[model samples]
Target: MGAETNGNLEFLSKIPEIKFTKLFINGEFVDSVSGKTFETIDPRTGEVIAGVAEGDKEDVDLAVKAARHAFDHGPWPRLPGTARRKILLKFADLIDEHAEELAALESIDAGKLFGWGKAVEIPGTAENVRYYAGAADKIHGETLKMSSAHQGYTLREPIGVVGHIIPWNFPSTMFLLKVSPALAAGCTMVVKPAEQTPLNALYFAHLAKLAGIPDGVLNVITGYGTTAGAAISSHMDIDKISFTGSTEVGRLILQAAATSNLKAVTLELGGKSPLIIFDDADVDQAAELALLGNLFNKGEICVAASRVFVQEGIYDQLVKKLAEKAKTWTVGDPFDPKVDKEQYDKVLSYIEHGKREGATLLTGGKPCGAKGYFIEPTVFTDVKDNMMIAKDEIFGPVMSLMKFKTVEEAIQRANATRYGLAAGVLTKDINVANTVSRSIRAGTIWINTYFAFDKDAPFGGYKMSGFGRDLGAQGLEQYLQVKSVVTPIYNSPWL
Candidate 1:
């Protein structure tokens, strides 16, 4: 390590060492039944950070059993809403206290920028927890009056044991996206964190326990998706499964749930999100949004605006500005207080495909640094709708630029993809913004900004991108089941 890298690592070493690498079950850290473990490699240096227990079918069963017990009989699910809120608030506070430790773990394990991981991802996660904590006591059912000689009402109750299969990218955010709402809804859970980034989730489980979340209310199992993930999906006792990953894997999870007990499944899958810039929009602002939309988090975001559509009038100007701006983004170590091998290879391959397929490589198109999985921020112009780069989700720091002549054509081109997770429009004209915003088929659309995520807004995708919302009251409902109660009016003699 260089002097600077050593200084960064030294700062991280001051925090407490991670002691929760093993599987957490019923509030205790224990070895997997099979005694099998997997090495977690740091993408920056290709070094083994830690050996995490590999949870499989047997381990999943144990976790499910514990979650079921917690739901059916433990104090956690039976606590009052105010009580749950208190515990969750405390949990959020504890996460804030250990923000540096959590952020460091995420950076080394997932190759996310240490500063961004600490400042953005970790803090955002804590905010998500606080949002859900405040929302816990606010959740309520409904009352109704029947026309007939009967009175009726509906009740929303916790959907017992929930299974959360989290994705590797944005591990901290995704974990809270699945767990916080379930916590608010009085449901116990079995979480299977992606093998590549399991440290933060295990550490979060410890925080939950410290916050007085009872035994069996939360369990973290670290393993590959096929074994632990498959077991969770097919477990009969699990009331629901919420997953965030690739569309292909989302389909498999759906099949597993259907063939098993038909557990409720909510998925937030792949995206090839488009950022449309019209002629009337500010060219500088449009260029910056386009750059951030694709380059943030090294372009590992699920809703990354990879497919950029520019109106013909401003096409050349915006493309040139974005190309210039793309050169400024630094890519290297994720923990030098800053910023994959398979993922690296995949992104480089896409850049090559962009060149071979006839898209103009306007800027960067090669790897950076002598080592590590670093790719230069790349921009491609003259991209056609039929090109592979435009059609596929190249989850990297690559931007593909295409053009449309009119508003109608822009909307059509934006909605052409099977993936409709998110789309962005840059226009100062209210009429144009309104028309395009409503016309686009994406689950979330940004009018002026590219990515403006908040806990209050509900977010998901349409078509092949998957279903269900992950934030706000809509998210809490995912962990609840609704039922109706009826009472006959004796005086009215109605049955």
Candidate 2:
């Protein structure tokens, strides 16, 4: 491999030893009930990294039983919030201590940039956990002024056993996004990571054990989404399910949860978000934001700003800069393959659609290198709002550029999609920023910045992007159920 690199991308070379591949249940790594195993492939080289245990309905049931017991009879749910906080802080420290190994595993397993994982994401994950750990000791419900002749106060209690179905795009990020908050709320869980990437989740379970998290408090199941994911969703014992994935699969989970014990559900689904660049914006900064917004993480993110609406005044200049950036955008994977071939093929098909649909190919509308699922960073101009390239959630490094005459028009065009996960606005006019940001139907609208996700701020989507928040105090609420108790005022209402 060469030492070539791109901005903020350090091409580190290291093959992490695959230590844990079995399903983690009841504080121990164990084989599946059926003794079935599936080969986990390294996307960089398309080679088998390890034969992970294939957890199915039986495995999920066992995990759920453990989680249920943990919640009902064990100490996790019954433990003081301060105690939970202490243990979770230890877990966060463990994560930080092993940052390098986890980053290497994540980069190889998910085809992510190694440097970003090590320097940015890994540390960010530990911080997120710490944030939640701090919040654990602060969970409390407020007193309610009742209308009746009674005094009332509420108790915010852990909902119960949770089923976390996380995606492959941001494996550890999504894991902590769900797990940290739930743990802070004193909830036990059964986790099913994306089959495409499950190594870190297992490692996390190991860390949990070392952190003094009790047996059956946190379990990780590794297998395909259909068998293991569905089992977790439909398990009668699970009190809630938090999922991050496609809207299509989110629908399935909703159905499964509804038909089971009617568990509470939180879904962070798909998006076809937009990034608007007005005429007054700096062309260079706008171009950088657009490229980074759509191309970061190989465009596998749900909130990728694939739709770029540039005001006609600076459209041409921004387009020129974007073209140059697209050309220089590094396309390489650690150890070997850098992207999932399944998504790689899908991204190529979208590129062809851009051509056939009459969108002008500005730069990078083709594959790169001789081997693996590597595609050039693609950008298209003269794109119509109704075109497939502009309308669909392609989930790739493909950007669709369109010209808009007015802020109203930009807002309307941006809100055209069924998805409303996130959007980006680039403008110097405060009025324009306020107007367009308020008018957009998306859950998050980034002004002058993109991908500004944080642990303190809540994150989720509107419309097809799904419901419920994943960060902040709001994130912890998703795993808690409120119970109100009232007492008649000194025998005034004895009748």
Candidate 3:
């Protein structure tokens, strides 16, 4: 089933209505095995917008069974790479065609601003699909030189059924991130979306079918993480599990995978990344990049620059200018045409936490208005490295600015966190940038810019942020298994 037409923009004067409430299994909307459903509320207003199917262990079993059956005996795995590429390209085209409707549903479901959702996230999803679609036909195998009198070669094959668990912050993007590559690699999948934001995932499953994805090749299961998520992690038939969420849950998934069939696991977990600004750096440019890096998506980003380490020479000036610019950011109802609501409330909540945790509120710490989940853009200065705001992943629009005396100190402080997901450095000194980039430990690093992503680049983490890359050629490798083949060229006398 598709989104209900009741919530069309023309009907905005009326109350928002439920658009979807079923799980997608085997290419159709179906009920959970236990017949239980959970309410998906709009975080902005704390109102229930729809009730989604609550899948339990039983449902996970069915989904895994479907995926396994498809992998073992379906046309998806047997199809040529060119054939898969054609279908995936068609899917990407469909995503673009319905971009507006999908963006609206995502905004209403996850409390993101409609404009940003439409302009950025939806298009990013389509790009990811198309990238993998083209890459599908390019996966290759290599020949190996034999030490003995035998010819040998390696074949890259689909790993089999995959289980993907996505987070709430970027439901649509993460869905495409995990599903597209798996499909391109000829593996079927079952997805378990976060309970807080499940609607977009269900809608995507419908779009997948519309794009001609086979039944049982893709499924969406919605339920509490402890039940459905845990079941997927521990399923024996699931050949792989790709997760994007917290580090704690990533650990649990690792344990579950180890305890079950030893499925291959790839995790894109938490981050408290750092942004370093040198004395010679351009203040205006640095300030803008810092704001976008930390405040994008309301700072609900895993790779957000939560920690800002500025060289002492420019620290005070950058901090002041940043705080000043932050005050001008509009925070109000996400649906309001004038404001960016996606990150407003989340930013405000982090501001509140900063105060409670005794962080020195530099500026912009209060909500701007009375309606919606709006919070003033906030920055904390004189934040010690040990402070909670500095150490933890405050996935909101709160930035912590700390001063560093040297390049060594900046690299030391940047690498101090358990997370090594992403870090940014702003400097005109090419030598300094190269030195610091090598010193700091993170999966991705930005120089003078932040949040730069492309399908050709591999995305992931280095430490507690979790392992395995998400995009590029390496991303496709995550869904493949390498097998070596050898043949004897001469008959043996012993035989």
**Using Cα atoms with residue i matched to residue i, what is each candidate's TM-score against the true structure?**
0.96, 0.96, 0.93
Which ranges in model 1 have alpha carbons more than 4 Å from their true place? 1-16, 337-339, 493-495
| 1 against 3, candidate with superior lDDT | 1
Q: Candidate 1: TM-score?
A: 0.96
Measured with C-alpha atoms, the lDDT of residue 77 in candidate 3 is 89
Top candidate when judged by lDDT against the true structure: 2
> Which tens-of-lDDT digit does each residue in 1-495 have in candidate 3?
135454444435323445667888888888998889998766556566777889999988888888888889999988999999998998888888878777777777776777777787798899899999998887778898887778789999999999999998888999999999999999999999988888888878888888888899999999989999999999999999999999999999999999989999999999999999999999999999888887787778899988999999998899889978887777654555111244454455566767877778887777644554656567899888887788888777788999999998899889988999999999999999999999888999999889998888899999999999999989999999999999886875533
Candidate 3: segments with Cα more than 4 A from true spot: 1-18, 337-353, 356-358, 367-371, 491-495
| Model 1 agreement with the true structure over 1-495: per-residue lDDT tens digits | 599788877766744476779999999999999999999877777777889999999999999999999899898877889999999999999999988888888888888777777787898898898888888887677888889888889888998899999988888989998999999999999999988889999999999999999999999999999899999999999989999989999999999999999999999999999999999999999999999999888888889999989998999898778877877877766655112578889999989998999999999998877666778889999899998999988888889999898999998989999999999999889999999999999999999997899888999999999999899789998998999999988877555
Worst 10 residues of 3 by lDDT: 337-346
Clash count for candidate 1 is 2
Q: lDDT (CA) for every model shown?
A: 0.89, 0.89, 0.85
Candidate 1 residue 143 C-alpha distance from true site, Å: 2.0
Ranking by TM-score: 1, 2, 3
How far residue 222's Cα lies from its native spot in candidate 1, in Å, is 0.4
Displacement of residue 406 (Cα, Å) in model 2 is 0.7
